[model samples]
Target chain A: MEASTSRLERDYRRVLRLLPAGYRRQWGDDMVGALLDAEQSAAAASAADEGPERQAEERDIALLQRPPLREVAGVAALAVRLHLASPSTAGATAAARLRGDAVRRVALVGLLAAAGPALLSAVTGLYWPVPPELEALGHTRVDALASALLALVAVAAFALFVTGRHRTASVLAVFAVVPDLRHPLETLASAWRVSPGTLLGAACWLLVLLAPLVALLAWRSDAPRPSRRWLLALPVVAALGWVPWLLWRATGALVAPDAAGSLALGAAACAVVALRRSDASWMRTAAVLAAVGGLGSLGQLSLLGYPPGLERDLGWTALGTVLLAAAVGVVAGVTGRRWSAQAAPTAVTAPDRSASDASA
Target chain B: MALTEPAVLVLTALVGETRHGYALIAGVEELSEGRTRLSVGTLYGLLDRLSSEGLIALDREERHQGRTRRYYRLTDDGAAALEAEAQRLAHLARAASARLRTARAV
Candidate 1:
C-alpha cells in the first residue's frame, strides 16, 4: 500500500511539470497534496460501498492507479492558457496583446479578401450578361445557382466572424471551402503520376483557402470583437474588379481581375496596415499576411513556363510584390522583437493593469 | 466581471469560512450536486485569477497527514461579486419559472 501510494504520487508530480516553471514553483506541492487527498477520499467512498472482502482489494488497486486522463487534459489546458496569457511583466503583456491583435486582423483581412472574389463571382454568375451560346447550356443554370449559394455561404461566414459569432463562423468558413477542396483533393489523389508543377499549384491553392481558417483559431473567447468597418472592404474590392472586367468586356483594352490579382490586392492591404502601424505586433501581423500572400503568388507559378503571355506576366508581377512585402515584414518583425526586449526591464518595474483585467 | 460557474462555486464554498484545496473541491462537488467536478489544475487556475482580482486571499497553511494544505478565504470583494452574481441568476431563474408556469396554465 505504501509503495503504491508513492508510485501514484510520483506519476502525478510528473504530469504537474507540464505547467510553467514559475507556476509549478508556487503551486506544485499544494496541487499534489490536493490530488492525493481527492484520490484517498474517492477510494474511501468506493470502499464504503463495497463488501468487506472486496474493500481492501479495491483500495490497493486504487492506490496504484495513475492520474486520470481528464486530470491530465485539464492540466494541459491550464498550461496552454498560462503560456499564451503570459502574465509576466508589463512589456510581455503588451507584446502578447499586440500578437493577439495582429492575428485577429490577419483573420479579418484574409476572410475579407476571400469574400470579395466570391461575391463578385456570385454576382457575375447571377446577374451579369451571358452570351447566347453559353446560356443555351442546360447545366449552366444549376452551376450558377450552386456557385451563388457557395458565395453566399462564404460571405455569411465572414459576417458572422466579424460580428463575434466565431464558432458558427468557423464552421461555415470550413463548409465554404468544401468546393475549393475538390480540385486539390483530386490532384493529391493522383500523386503518383502528377507533374511537379500541377502538384505544387494544387498544394499552394489549398494553403490559400486554408490560411484564413487557421488564423481564425486566434479568435478565442477572450479576444476582442472585431469592428464592423471591415465589412465595407468587401464591397469596395468587389467593385474595383467590376471596373476592369467591364472595361475588358466593352473595349477589350483592359485586363480582367483574376484570383492572383485579388491575392495581390489582399497582400497590398496587409502591407498598408503593417506600414501604418509602427508597433512590433503589427509588424508580426504583416509577416503572417505576407506568408499567406506569398503562398498564393507561388501558386501562380504553374501559370508560367507553359506560355509567354498575360498569365505569365501577371504571375511574375504577383511573385515580385509578395517577395518585396515579405522582406519588409520580416525585417520589421525582427526589429520590433528587439525593441520589445529592450523595453521589458522598464516595464517590469511598472504595474500591470492590463494583466489584472486580462480575461480568465 | 461576470463569475464563471466554477468561480461562483469556489466563492460559495469559501463563504463564511476558510477552506483548503481538497475541502473546496469537495464543497464544490456537494454544492453542485455532483454535476461539476473541478480538477486540481482548474481549481488552482481559478484561485490564482481570483486572488489576483482581490476576490479571494490566502488565509493560512497547515501540515495535515505530512502534506502542506493552504487555506483560502473570500474577501469582501469576493462576497460582493458572489452576491451580485447570485442576484443575477436568481432574477433569470424567477423569470424562467414565471414563464413556465404561465405556459402550463395556458
Candidate 2:
C-alpha cells in the first residue's frame, strides 16, 4: 500500500511541472507531499476492510492510473487562485502595490496616445507613399504626407517626455521609431556602422529602439516617489560629452582594420554604463535592447562583403533571426513578470470571502 | 443561462447541499458521469471566481471524517441561472432532434 502511494506521488509530481514557475516555486513541494500523505492514509484506512494487503494495493493502483488532463488543469488553476489570495504568500510592499496601480493606468494612456498618429495616417490615406513612377501621383501624395504624421508623433513624444508624462512619452518614443523596423538593416548600417546580418547589430537595434518603451510600460505607476536612480541620467548626459571626440577619432582611423568594430564596442560600453545608473525598470529595458542590437550588429557584420567561397549568408540570416526572437521573448517574459508582481498585492489584500463563509 | 460548463457543474453539485473543495470536485465528476473532473487548482480558481461573482457563497468549514473541508452553497441567483441554462440546452436538443427526424424522412 505504501509503495503504491509512493508511486502515485511520483506521477503527480511529474504533472505539477506543467504549472507556471512562480506557482511551482511556492507550493510545488508542499502540495506533492500533502497529496502523497492523503493517499497513504486513505490506503491504510481501507486496508482493514480488504482480505489482504494486496487488495489495498490494488485499490491504490487503480487510483494511481492517470487522472484526466482536465482534472489536473482544474487543480492547477485552483492552486494558483489559492496562492494568490493567501496573504502570507503575496508578500508585497505597500509602495509596490500603489506604484503598480499607477503604472497600469499610465501604460494604458500611453498605449492609447501612441496609436494616434498611426490611426490618423490610416484614416486620412495621407501617409502611404506610392512608387515615384506611378501614373496617378495623387494617391502617392498620401505617402509623402506620412512624414508629417510621423513628425507629429515625434513632437508629441518629446512633449510628453518634457511634461513628465513618462509612460506616454515612452510609448510615443516607440511609435516614433517603429517605422524604422521596416528597414532595420539600413537603419543599423547608417547609424551604427553595423551590418544587418550580424547578431551584434540586431542586439543593438533592439536595445536602443525597442527596450525603452517596454521598460517605461513596466515602470511602477504609483511609486510614491520618483526612483532615486534617475540621478544616473546625469552621468549619461556627461558620457555624451565624449561622443564628438570619439567620432572624430573614428573618422581619422576609418582605414584601420577594426575601426568600425572599435566604435561598436565603445557604444556598447557607454550603453552599459548608462543602464547601470538608471532606474531598475529602465536598466532592464535598456539592457535587453542593447543586447539585441549588439548581437544583430555582429550578425550583420559577419555577412557583409564576404568572399564568394568563404561566406555563408543563409547561416548569418538564421542566426540574426534567432537572436531577434530570443530578445523578443526576453522582453515578453519581463513584461509578464512585471504584471504578476503588480497583481500580487491586490490579490492578497482582497478578502477571501469563500474561506470565511465556509468556516461560518 | 450563459453559465460556463464548470459553473454549471458546480451549481449542480451544490443543488441539494453544500460541500467543501474536494467533495465538490468529486460530486461534479459523479454528476457528470465522470465526464468532467476538475484539478485542485482549477476547482479553486473557479470557486474563487464564482464566489466573487456572488453565484456561490462559502457555507462553513469543519473537520469531517478527519479531513478539513470548506463547504459552499449556491446563491438564489446561481440556482436560477443554472435552471435557465438547463432549460435552454434542453430546448436546443429537442429542436435538433426534430430537424434530424425530418431530414431522415426526406
**Which is the leading candidate under DockQ?**
1
Q: Estimate each model's TM-score.
A: 0.76, 0.42
* CAPRI tier for the interface of model 2: incorrect
lDDT of 1 by residue, A212-309 (tens): 77777667666667788878887887777677668657865444434434544565566556556655555666666666667666766655564766
TM-score of chain B of each: 0.95, 0.90
Give candidate 2 misplaced runs (Cα > 4 Å). A1-55, A59-351, A355-360, B64-67
DockQ score for candidate 2:
0.16
Question: In model 1, where do residues sit more than 4 Å from their true spots?
Answer: A1-48, A51-92, A129-138, A182-203, A242-268, A296-303, A309-318, A342-360, B20-23, B39-45, B60-70, B102-106
| Interface RMSD measured for model 2 | 6.3
Residue lDDT tens for model 2, A185-208: 555556556443443545454544
- Once model 2 is optimally superposed onto the true structure by TM-score, how far is the C-alpha of residue A271 displaced, in angstroms? 16
lDDT on C-alpha atoms for all candidate structures = 0.72, 0.50
